[model samples]
Target chain A: MREFANKYGTVLVVGGEGEKCRDVAESYGFRDVITPGDIIKANAATAPFRALTESEIKNSRDLLARGGKLSDIVVEAVFVFADSRDWASDLQIMLDIAQSKGGRLETRSENFDEGPPIYFSHNDVLWSAAHEHVRLGMGALRKIVETVFEDVTGGRKLKTHAFGKPQVSTFEFATRLLQQWRATQHGLAESEPPETVYFVGDTPESDIKGTNAMNEKSKNEWYSILVKTGVYQAGTEPKHKPRKLVDTVLDAVNHGIRREMAKLGTRKDGKGRKLPLDDAALKAISEGRTPNFDLSVDPFAKAVAQ
Target chain B: MREFANKYGTVLVVGGEGEKCRDVAESYGFRDVITPGDIIKANAATAPFRALTESEIKNSRDLLARGGKLSDIVVEAVFVFADSRDWASDLQIMLDIAQSKGGRLETRSENFDEGPPIYFSHNDVLWSAAHEHVRLGMGALRKIVETVFEDVTGGRKLKTHAFGKPQVSTFEFATRLLQQWRATQHGLAESEPPETVYFVGDTPESDIKGTNAMNEKSKNEWYSILVKTGVYQAGTEPKHKPRKLVDTVLDAVNHGIRREMAKLGTRKDGKGRKLPLDDAALKAISEGRTPNFDLSVDPFAKAVAQ
Candidate 1:
C-alpha cells in the first residue's frame, strides 16, 4: 500500500463507512488518502442522489480547508479496502475518478486513457453477513465498477487487482506466517516446515480452492477440508472439490489425526507390538465416522490426540 | 401501468426518490404501489448498507402497519418508472423480490423461477441532465439489474419489458394522439392523417430510431431529425441514422419546413408563378442553413411557419 502511495502521490481509498478505509490506508503509511466521502463533501453534485448524513459530513475531510481546490487533487490510484456501505455514491465517485482527465475531478478524459489504476483487497462476490441471505461484497462492487466504466467508456475495460483468498500471493503470505508461528511456539526448527497442513473452511470457492492451489504450487502438503454451514450447500457438488468432506470443524480435525496415525502405524509400542487400535475404533475410522468412545480412555488414542 | 396493476395484485415501483415514483403509479390508477424505500423502512436489514433519511422513511409505507407480515406481502410485478435515486438499495430490494419464491419477501426461490415480472418505463442508457455529462438513466439501471441478477442467480437471464421510445407501441400511441389533435385543432378528417410527421429529437438511439421504425410500418411518413445538443455527438456517424441532421431543435424545424416547401414547388401564387422564396433565403435553405431573415417577414416562410 505504501508502494502505491510512493508511486501515485495521492491515492483514493474506496469502501467502508465514514473514514474507516481512509484510516486503514493512513495506517499503512500512505501520506494522503482521499475517500468517496471526501469527494462528495467537496461537491454534493458529484453524486446528486446520495446525501451524506451530518456525521458523515463531519467525518469527511474538507478539501477546501486542506488549502487545495477539489479539481487540484489528482488521485493516481484507487484502493478498495472493504465492502462499500454506499454502493451508489461510491460507484459514482469511483467512476468519475476513473474517467477523469489524468485523475482530476470534474474533467473527463476524451478517450478515457489516463485514469488511475484500481486495486481491491478481495474478490468475494457474496459473503455471509447479518442479513438472512448472503450480501454483496467488495467483489460485487468491483464487478459493477468495471461494468459501468465499460458502459460509459464505449467498451474500454477497467483493469483491477485483488489481493485476498484464491489469489496465490495471499496463500503464500499465510504459509510464511504459519511457518513463523510454528518455529516460535511449537519448537519446530525454522528450516523444517510442517509435513502436511490441514485447512478447514465452509466456502469451497475461496478457502478450499485457494488451499488446493497452494498445495499444488508449494513444497509442503495443503489438505483442504470443506465443511457444511456456509456458502457451500450440503447436497450439491462444489465447483472446486476439497480433498476431504466433513460435517463440522471437530470432525475434520479428527479425520486428519486418524489419517496421520494410520500413516505412522509401522511405529509400534515399547513392547515391539503394533499400536493398540481396537477393532471397533478401526471400524469406525474405516466407515468415515468419528469414534464414539472417548479418546482420553485409551493409551493409543491419547498418543494420537497429542 | 394500470393494466399491469389489474393483472398483478400489488406491484413494486422501483425508482425515483422518496414517494415520487409511487405517486406516479397511483395517479395512473394503481391501487397499491410499493417502492424500495417502503421495503427498507419495513426491514432495515433487507439492504443493510442503504440508509434512508427521515423524510424518506416518512414517505415509505409501513408493511406492518398495513396489517400484514413483511413475508406475506407478495409483490406480483415490478415497475421502474424513472431513474433510481438509490440504485444500491433499489437494486438489492429488486433482486430480493426477483429471487424470492413467488415474490414473497425474505424467501429465496430454489431455482429463481417463481419471481414476478419486471417492467421499465424507458430504456435510455444515458440522458442529458443538469450534470455536465450524460447521467445513467433507467436503462443503465436495467442493465445493471440484469447483469447482477445473472451474477447472483448463476446465469438465469432476467426478463424485462420497456414501454418508452424505440419501442413500436410507444410510437404508435404517439401517432394516434397526433392524429386526434390534428382532427380537433387543424380540422383534418379523422380518417385522413397528415402526409408527413417530422420527429425532431436529440437522441438517435431512442427518438430517431422509433420514428424511423414507425415510418417503416405506417402508411404516413415519419421523418426523423437528429439534433446535436444531447446523446448524439457531432462528427461521428450515428448507429441509427436520421432523415435529417441539424444543430438544434429550432434548426431541425427550419430544415423540415424548407424540405416541405421545396416538395411543394409546383404550387403557384395568384399571379401564376412559383411560390415566392427570395434568392438569399433560397440559397440559405439550399445550403442547409436557417435563413438570416425572420420567417414572419417572408410570405412563403410565414405560411410554412404557421
Candidate 2:
C-alpha cells in the first residue's frame, strides 16, 4: 500500500479524530488531513447534536489547545481506508469538504446541499465487536445520520460512492494499488502491460469474494489466496475456497507471491524484481513515522475523555 | 357478576398470592378460594418449589397468624386469573398438590410429574412494565418451568395450557361465564336459541381479532365493541374496527345490546327480559365493591388503598 502511495507521489487518507487524521496525514507526507472533530472542537453549536460524553469534551478542548483545526486545504482525492469510529461526525466533516463552494472546506456554497459523492470504503451492515452479538457498521450508522441529514436538509437525497473489500470498488482500488506497487519495484514504465496480481485476504467474504468479483471484471490475470487469521477463524468451513488456503497472513504474503511469480517466469512480458513488505506496509499505514493512538479522532471519544 | 355467580352453582377459584385473581375469580362467584401463600403460611415448604418476595414473606406470616391457610375443601376447578407475582413460590405450592398424590396441598406428589395443567388466563410472551421497555410474562416463566419438567420427565411435554384474550380456551371460558350471567339476570336458559354475543374490549389485535376468529365457528353470533378506556388510549386508529366503537365499557355494553336487539327485532326465539347494564352492568363492575385497577385483582386492596 505504501509502495503504491510512494509511486503515486502523495496519498490522502481522511477519517478519525481530526487531530489523529491530521497527524496521520502529516506522517504519510500528505499535503494535509482533516477530521470532523477538528471543526466541532473549533465550534460548539454542531457538537450538541447528541449528548457529548466526557472523552469527547476533552478531545474538543485538546484540539483547540493544539491549534491544529479545520483550515483551508485542497485535496485531489481520498482513501477512506477504514471505518470511522463516529461516522456521523466524520461524515459531516467529509461532506463539508465534498460540498464546499469551491471544493474546499473553508469556502461556502449556496448549493452546498449537493456536493461530491462520499467515497465510502465498505458497506458492511454488521461487524463483530468485543461483544457476544454483532455491532452495526457504516450502513446502519449511515441510516441514522441520513435521517438526521434529511431533516436538516429538507429531504435531499445524499449521493455517495464507495470502495473496499467484498464490494467491487474497494477490490478494484486495492488491485490497482497492488499493480502500481509491483510495477515500481520492478521499474516498469508507462504503456507497459499489467502483470498478474494475486490478492491474499483472511476473510473469505471480503478477500476471496472481493478478488473473485474483481477477477470477473478485469482483464488483468488474478489469483485469490485465503488466509485464516483476521476475519475467518477455525471451526467454520470456508464459504468459498480460494486458489490455496493458508494458515497466516505472513505465510500467505510469502507463498502467494512466490507461486504467482513462478508461473509468471514462464509467460512473462517482462522480468520482475521481488517486492517485499519489509515493514513498508506497516510504516506507510503508520503514515511514514510513528503512529499515535492518543491522537483519537472521534468527538465522542474526546467527549468521554473530558 | 357476583350476583350472577351466586345465582348459579358457586364457582371456586384458587391460587395467586393474596386475593387479586381470587377476587376476580370470586367476582363471578368462584366461592371457594385458596392460594399456596395460604399453605406456605401454615407449613413453610409443604410444596416442591420455594421462592418468595420480602413483602410476600411478611404477608404469609400475617396470614398464618390469622389462620387463612390452605383449606381442606376440594375446589371444583382452578383459574389463574392473572400474572403470578410470586411465581416460583406460588408454582412450588401448586405443584405440591399434584405431588401429594392427592388434591390436598398437605400431601406430596409421589407422581407429580404426571400432574394436572396449571391454567393461566394469558400466555403473552412479553408485557410492558414501568421501569423497563418490556418484561417477561407468566408465559415465559411457564416455558422455563416446563423446560425443567421436560428434563425431569426425560422429555415429556408438560400439560401446560393458557387462557386470556388471545387464547381460545379462556375466551370460551369467559363466554360461558358471560352466558351464565346473562341467563340468570334475564331469566333466560341454555334451552333458548343462542344469542349474538358482542364482546366489548380495548386492544384491537386481541379482542377484535379473537372475537372475529371465534365468530367463525360458534353457533352464537359475534358482535364486537372496542372501547378506548384502558389498554388503548385515544388518538390512535383501532387496528380492527368493531361493530360499534364506544368511549367506555358501559356505553359499549348498552350500545351492543341495543344493536343486537334492534337487529333481531321484538320477535326473536332467544328473547328474554332486558339485560339492563345501565343499572346492572355498572353494578357488576362497580367502583365501590371492586378495587380500582386496569387489571391485577386485589383481594386486600393493596395498589388502590389510600
Candidate 3:
C-alpha cells in the first residue's frame, strides 16, 4: 500500500464502515485516500439512490473543496481493504472509476484499459458470523463487481488482484510468521523449521486448496486436514482433497500426534500413560491411512449443520 | 401480482426506493407487501451494514409485531417491481426467503425448492437515465441474485418469472391495447385490425427481440426497426437482429410510411405533394432494405453518444 503512494497521484480505498478504510490506507502511507463515500459526497449524482448520512458526508473528505473540481482528483489505483458496507454505491463508484479515462471521475475511456488497477485484501465469499448461516464476504463483492463490470462493458472483464488466504503471497507470509514464532516461542533455531505442519480447515476451496498448493511449493511438509465443519459438507466429495479428513480440530490434532508417535515406534508417553489410539489405529496411522473412529461429539458441528 | 395474492401466504416485494414499491403493490390489491427494509427493521441483524433511516423504518411495516415471531411470518413469493435502492440488504433478505423452509425466516429448507418463488417486472440489464451512461436495471440484480444464490446453495438455480417487455404475455397485452386504441381512437372496427405494426426501439435484447417474437405469433406483421441510439451500439452486430436498422426513431417512422406508400403504388400525395424519399429509395424500402440516407441530425443522439 505504501508503495502505491509514489506511483499514483490519488488512490481510491473502497469498503469498510464510514471512513475506516480511508484511515487505514492513510495510515499505510497513502497520501490521498479517496473513499466511495467521499466521491458520493462530492457528486451525489454518482449514485442517486445511495445517499450518505450527514455524519458520513462530514467524515468524507470533500474532493471538490480540495481540488476545486471533481475531474481534477484523478484516482490512480483502487484498494479494497475490507468488506463493503454499501455495495451499491461502492460498486457504482468502482465501475465509474474502472471505466474512466486516466482515472478521471466524469470521463469515460474509449477502452477500459486506461483505468487504474484494483486490488482486494481477501476473497472469502462466505464467512462465519453469529448468524445462523454464513454471511457474504469481500469475495462476493469482488464477484459482483466483475460480473456487473462485464455486463456494462459488453463482455470486457474487470481484472482484480487479491492478497489473502488462498493467494500464494498470504501463505508465504504465514510461513514466515510461523518460522519467527518457532524461533522465539519454542527456542528452535531460525534455520530449523518443523518437519511437517498440519493445517486443519473446513473450506476446501480456500483453506484446503491453499494448503495443498503451499505444500507443493514448500520444502517442509504442509499436511492439510479437512474437518467436517463450516463450508465443507459431510458425506460429499470435496473439490480439493486434503491429506487427512477429521471430525473436528481436536481429532486432527490427535491424528497428527499419533502419526508422529507411531513413526517413533512409541505407544505410551514418558509418564507411562496409554495413547488414545489402540494397536490397530496406530498401525493404520503408520500406514498413512485415516483410522475409522466415531468422533462426532463436537458441539459446534451441530450448529453449523443446522 | 394480484394472481399471487390468494395463492401465497405472504409476498416479499424487493426493490424501489423507500415505501414506494409497497404502496404500488397495495394499490394493485396485494393485501400484504413486505419490503427488504421491513425485514431489516424487524431484525437489524438481517443486514448489519445497511441501516434504514428513522423515516424509512417508520414507513416500513413491522412483521414481528404482527406475527409475534420473525419465523412465523412466512414469505411465499417475491416480486421485484423496480430497481433496488440497496442491493446488499435486498439481496440478503431475498436469499434468506429463497432458502428458508416454507418461506419461514429462520428455518432452512432441506431442498431449497420449498422456498418462495421470485418474479421480476423486467429484465433490462441496462436502462437510460439522466446519467451519462446506461445504468444497471432489475436484470443486473436478478443476475446477481441468481449468481450469489447458486454460489451459496452449491449449484442450485433460482427460478424467476418476469412480467415486462420481451415476454410473450407483455406483447400479447400490448397487441390487445393496440387493437382497443385503433377501435376507439381511429373509429375502425375491432375485427379490422391494421395489416402491419412497425415497432421502433433502441434496445435489441428486449425491444427488437420482443417485437420479432410477437411478429412470429401475431396474424399481423410486426416489423422490428432497431435504432442505434441506446444500448445497441453502432458498428457492432447485435445478437438479436431487427428487420431494419436505422439512425433514429424518425427514420424508422419515415421508412415505414414510404414502404406503405410504395405498396399503394404512389410516389406523390393526394394534393400533388412529393414524398421525402426518391423512387429508388422507395423501391429499396418496399424491398425491405433500409434506405441509406442522412438522418444523424437527431439532437438526442449526441447526448446519448456522450
Residue-wise C-alpha lDDT for candidate 2, range A1-306, written one tens digit per residue: 344335333223544533465465556665434345545656543323333446665554333454444334443454564555444335445544544554444444454464444455565433443322223344433343344333333245555544566777676666566667657886666334465566876657567877887788887766788776555555556666688687875566656545544444444565565434345443543342322233246535654466
- DockQ of every candidate structure: 0.43, 0.02, 0.45
Q: What does the lDDT read for residue B112 in candidate 3?
A: 82
Write down the TM-score of every candidate: 0.86, 0.38, 0.82
Model 3: CA > 4 A from native = A65-73, A227-229, A245-306, B66-69, B246-255, B265-306
lDDT of 3 by residue, B125-222 (tens): 77766566666678888888988888878788887778787887888787788889999998877775577889988788799899899999988899
Worst 10 residues of 1 chain B by lDDT: B264-273
Worst 10 residues of 3 chain B by lDDT: B266-275
Strongest candidate by DockQ? 3
lDDT of 2 at A250: 53
Q: B-chain TM-score, every candidate?
A: 0.87, 0.47, 0.85
Q: What is the DockQ of the complex in model 2?
A: 0.02
Question: What does TM-score give for chain A of every model?
Answer: 0.85, 0.48, 0.84
